[model samples]
Target chain A: MIVATSGLTKRFGRVTAVRDVTLEVPRGVRFGLLGPNGSGKTTLVRMLLGLVHATSGSIEVLGEPMPRRARVVLPRVGALVEGPAAWGHLSGRANLRLLDAAGPGRSRHRRKRVDAVLEQVGLGGIDRRPVRAYSLGMRQRLGIAAALLREPELLLLDEPTNGLDPRGIQEMRALLTSLNEAGTTVVLSSHLLTEVEALCTHVGVMDAGRLALDSELAALRTPTGRVLVRTPEPDAVVGLLDGQVVDRRGDTVTVRGVEPATLNARLVAGGVRVTGLSEERRTLEQVVLELTGSGTDRVDRSPHGRRPEGPR
Target chain B: MIGVELRLMLRRRRVWLCWVLLCTLPTLVAILLATTRLAPPPGRGGAFLSAVTSNGQIFPAAALALVIPIFLPITVAIVAGDTVAGEASAGTLRYLLVRPVGRVRLLLAKLISVAAFVLLAVLFVTLVSYVVGVAAFGFGPDASLGGTGAIPSLSGVELTPVDVVARTATTVGYLALCMLALGAVGLFFSTLTDSPLAATLGVLAFVVASAALQPLDAASAIEPYLPTSHWLAWIDLFRDPILWTNVRGGALVQLGYVVVAFGAAWANFSTKDVTT
Candidate 1:
């Protein structure tokens, strides 16, 4: 594992920011931490970097016990937390140079690495401009460049696409994919389900400071082999199929446990004309909502004999 | 890294502005004293050097005293206040912390930079004043200290221009110690607060409170212990019969404050969870 946390915990006064979060990030994998706002993603990342002390539990990054020996470990790790925080008065190149000076790179190697990272992040042309003048997307890229300066083995990025436009997001995804392909493990926190789905190999869903689910993207998106049918008569088909009703709109019925062939045959045999029939594969977003219990509330319970689990 | 920090300092326009003001203040004062005809006492030339150099000691020290209450604290505030919180605000704190450098070394680098600025400011004040004072008043030996109390009076020592410059340099060294204590205090407050304004104000408030407490004659026994009280002890060098005891005591007190203030700053900065 490139990064591992066992029973990792953090608290601010009386409020626990992260509670018993246990996760393992394999090397060269793009892992996504999916959560809503204030769901402890930032806190967990801080603990892993030793930026904040963990209240309890253990964190190991690159095989080194966190925080206690992070000084020895951090050189191999890179991170961008929250937003880009560079000196507004200094140029982007100067900002990188200052951070680079503090890293383990030699003087000649420092300049070369800074130049390479700047070019890699598409910031080569604007390195001379003061950071205050850079746009939000540009700033974010500069931040990534700073993080990549040392070619760290593990990169922990928090909301790397927070304010990016579509093109910027695409660029970031490409950059991350390339980094991962080159054998760098990446742990990215984002609320954008599409981004996570498109980029992450594994995902961890967090809700209210606790891990709701953790697994590979493929497993989380395992095919349900069910199709949703929208018919004018949901009540008529209820008795005709052996599937459970997941949701019901004015004329749409989302059914589970029934294959598309069986559902189509049953609906036609019952003299019901299917207006809309489409296969539904579990999206990471849907899986997240289901695991976190948001999907349970909107699910229809009448005539299905399935009771929603009580709140945890 | 400190070398990089120094480059950052040099590139800042504010530092240049500070340099201008520092160089100009003493020269202006020297010109004003020379152009204005103050009635001379018994020994004319000796009286002139005494008055000007005495003023040199107190005036520059006073300038440093005032500058520190406002500018030095702000300088320290600008750098130290931004150390962690500013980085946090900029979203670079984590980036920097994740580098190989230890937090202790980073903090030490910043502290050293602030110390360099304080020393530079002190040296500027001393050199500028000495150069302008010597140019305005004729270069002569300090008068022998035959008259005033245990405070040795410089009445007959035919000190040349070089001797006067050397004496001024010595006084500046003493004054540097005092300003360094103030700088360290400013750094301590800066480390404690996130807002630069708050840190600057807090250090000033402490200085003001200490100064207010220093004048209570009833508290004379404790007055010497306060950092502000010994600020003027550099004047002992100008006295007819120099009082080494007061100077020595003042130096010790200043040193003690520097150690304590820096120690507190180091402890707080190293341990605080930097969340911005």
Candidate 2:
């Protein structure tokens, strides 16, 4: 494992920002930390980076005890905390140079390294404007560039795609994917399910400061032991299935207690036109919603505690 | 890390502006004094102001007196207070910490930067005032005949040019130590909060409280211990034989403040969970 925390917990006064979260990330996987807003994702990420000391438990990164050996381990790690931050008066390139100089990077290649990371993050032609003048997307890119300055073996990003446009997000995904392909371990925290779905090989869901779920994408998206059939003759298909249809919406029927192949053969044998038939599997959204609670952003006063549910 | 911090400090427009403003105050005073030819009556205005009209070489000491009470401390407090708190509010502290800039190392760098700003501001003020004083008043009568002028000490005796330079250099070092003590206080308050403004205000409040309590007969029991009480002791550097008593006491007091304040800062900062 590249990053491991056993029973890690953090408290801020009366609030327990992170509960006993024992998480592990292997050496070459894209791990997406999923959570609602204010569900301790940022706190946990800070703890991992040793910016926020844990109240209890232990953390190990790069096979060394965290914070104690942080000096040794963190040099090989890159991170973008809650958001991008730079000396507003300095240009993005200057900010990168200073941050690099503050650490243990070789000074001989500092200029070339900064330029390369800027190019990698699609800011190759950036001018000498101070970071304060950059748009939000530009700042986000600069933050990513700072994280990549040392060509770290592990990349820990929190909301890295925030303030980014669709194209920027796509580019970031490609960048992260390529970096991971080159033997880097990438762990990013975000609430965007589709982003996680498209990029991460493994996912962890956090709810109310607790690690509610930790599983591989494939494992969590396991078949629900049902088949989804789409046909123009929905009524005919339902009739032939003999009440095995658990749900019906227009031309589609969810059939249980049957395999896709058996269901398709039965449908054709019953003279029902089957336009589409496939096994039902849970999407990342469904899995997350099932594992986590309501969005912490919402405050409801209803006595019955009923919330307008689904994704926040 | 210290080098980077110093570079950042030197590059900041605010630091340079503070330096300019510090030097400008004394230059304006020199202009007003030179134009009017009416110095404040003896012992009535800033410490050496009454003596400045007769000797340009003495203006540096007078200039130091003019700014030491308010300008120097205020600017030092502002810069020092901004050290860690400014980075925290700007959201850069976390990044630096994660860069593996050791907590102790970063704090040391910040303290050194604050000290550097103090030295820079004090040196600029001294240099600018020296030039302004010479242009406005000319060298004293003794030096006008191409002879080395003698500057009167705080006592009645005369100080040769070499003595004047040596005393002024000593005054510079002493004042730097005093301001560094205040900077250490700023560093401590900076670690206590994330707002640089709050930290600066806290440092100012500390100074105000010290100054307020210094002259009160009821507070005399602790007067010798107050940080601001001995700040003027640098004036004793110009005494004929050099009054080392208060100067020595002031150095010790300021050194004590530096040790305690920096210790508190390091203790609080090293373990701080930098959520910002």
Candidate 3:
């Protein structure tokens, strides 16, 4: 494993941000951490980078215990957290140079590496422009360029696609894919389930300061072919069918643990008039929502139960 | 890296304006005094240098004094205040921290860059004052005492114009060191606070409070040791009989301040979590 957390916990005053979360990310794997706002994704990333102190438990990065000698270990890791930050007055290239001067690369290699990373991030020719003039997406790209300048073995990106348009997002996805193909381990935290599903080989879902689930993407997405059928006679179909009703809304029934053919056959045999029968292959988004106990209908329930479905 | 930092500091129009105002204030006072008339045997020229030196050394030195508590310290505070906090505010500190560089090295670089600004601002003020003084008054070496009210005739010294400029430069150097102590304090406060305004005002408050406390008879013994008290020691340079005792004390106090402030700044910065 390239990154592993065992019983990791963090608290702030009266609130817990992360609690007893255990996760293992393998080398050269693109791992995704999925959660909503305030779900402790940012807090966990900060702890992993040694920026925030872990309240309890241990974190090992690249097989070395974190924070004990983070200075030595961090050099091999690159990251883009929150947003891009550089001196507004300085040109983008100058900002890169300043960081390059302090990075692990030698002075002789600095310029070449900076140029290459800038190109890799699709920011090659505009290095002379002042950062103040750069757009939000451009600034984000510049930040990714800075992170890649050292050719680090591990890359940790938090919302790296933020501010990117559809095309920019595609380019960034391609860049990350290429980087991963080059054997670099990647750990990215994002709320974009589609993006994570496209890029990551493994996934971890977080909820209420705990790891709800962590598994390989393939295993977590085990091909459970299921479908939902909407009809006026759900009870009649249920009586005639061997399929399980995973969910029911009025007369509509969401049936699972059966193939589409078997489900359609049962519904028809029961003399039920089906208004809709759509096959539902589990999307990473649904799996994430289910694992985190944040299903579309269930997520609105308050912890105190004063209101079953309070305002989100 | 320092060059990049300096460029960013100078790029702000406000920094340039502050630099100009600091450098020209003494000269402006000298010109005003030179154009005006004065009483009896002393005449306008005598009164001008006297007023200019007193006001120059005091107000400009007070201005120079203000550098620690007011300008340079605030500038240092603005720069150092932003070092981590600004980056945090902008969401960049985390990006920088995750780089291969050690936290200590990053902070040391920032401190050195801020220190360079302190030195440059002090030098700018001194250089402009010297040019303006020579232009307003003829290039002559004259000395006057601040509190004693004694004036030394320039005729006896027989010093050349070059020697006068050299002496003024030395005086400015000493004053710069004294003010740098305050800059260090500002830098320390900058590390402690996330808001630039808070860090800048915090140093100003320290200066104002220290100066206010200096006049109390009850606190007389400790007042001389305060940073504000030593601010006027630069006037001792103009005294007919130079006081090395006060100069030494000022230098030592300034040194002690620099050590403590910088030590505190470094300690706080290195351990601080860069989580905005």
Using TM-score as the measure, which candidate wins?
A: 2
Give the whole-model CA lDDT for all candidates, comma-separated: 0.73, 0.92, 0.72
Worst 10 residues of 2 chain B by lDDT: B145-154
Candidate 1, residue A271: lDDT:
98
Per-model TM values vs. the true structure: 0.83, 0.96, 0.83
Q: Write the per-residue lDDT of candidate 2 for residues B238-270, one digit (tens) a residue.
A: 888988999999999999999999999999999
**Per-candidate DockQ vs. reference:** 0.59, 0.84, 0.53
On a 0 to 100 scale, what is the lDDT of residue A139 in model 3? 92
Error of 3 at A236 (Å): 17
| TM-score quality measure for candidate 3 | 0.83
Error of 2 at B13 (Å): 1.0
lDDT of 1 by residue, B167-216 (tens): 55666778768766776777677668667666657766777778888879
Candidate 2, residue A212: Cα displacement in angstroms equals: 1.2
Clashing pairs in 3: none
Instruction: Give me the iRMSD of candidate 3, please.
Output: 2.3
Off by over 4 Å in 3: A224-279, A293-312, B1-14, B37-80, B141-166
lDDT by residue (tens digit), candidate 1, A234-254: 887776664587777788778
TM-score (chain A only) for the predictions, listed in order: 0.81, 0.93, 0.80
Q: Rank the candidates by DockQ, best first.
A: 2, 1, 3
* Model 2: per-residue Cα lDDT at residue B127: 84
Candidate 1: regions farther than 4 A off: A228-257, A261-278, A293-312, B38-50, B53-91, B134-158, B239-242
Docking class of 3: medium
